[model samples]
Target: MILEHRTYTFKPGTVDKWMKKYEAEGLPIQKRHLNRFVGLYVSEIGVLHTTVLMWAYDSLADREARRQAMYADPDWQSFIAEIWALDAILQQDVMIMNPAPYSPPV
Candidate 1:
């Protein structure tokens, strides 16, 4: 399986706002189009104001297809537009990882 890890860093004190908005609006659309939802988290120690989102997919192609569908969906577009309007995000990073043989199933 492949896991997509997304990390977003926002300005100070904006994480909660972003999370709330995502939970209320974005999560529903993502839940419908995306693969397995691994977890959502906020950094508490180093690099404060960071949020991490992880999703599991059967393969890279599956991930790409699902993401493309999500991007095409109007609800997702609206959610992202709201997020961008907030202007709180500072940086974002994404990684697709292969789990070790010994790792537990995602």
Candidate 2:
């Protein structure tokens, strides 16, 4: 599986608002097109006022396709624009990583 991870840092004192907006709008849209949300989170440590959204896909191609579709969707564009104007600053990243190897019980 491919993991797409992003973290958003909300301005001080705006975490609640950010989470509310995400729950009401962002999550639904993501569920519609992505349908593969492993988890979404609000950090309680390190970057206390930040959020993380993780999604899993079958492969890199699948991830690209989902991203392209989300970008082309009008709802996503506007939703992002609204958040980009406030509650977020200098905190966004995407990383694709491979899972670490593990041995079965001997």
Top candidate (lDDT)? 1
lDDT of 2 at 104: 25
Put down candidate 1 lDDT per residue, 9-73, tens digits, no spaces. Answer: 99998999999999999999999999999999999899899999999999999999999999999
Superposition TM-score, candidate 1 onto the true structure = 0.98
Model 2, range 1-106, lDDT digits (tens) per residue? 7677887776788888778888999888888888478888888878687888888887898888887898899999999999887745656777876555562211
- TM-score list, all predictions: 0.98, 0.84
Backbone clash total, candidate 2 = 0
Candidate number achieving the greatest TM-score relative to the actual structure: 1
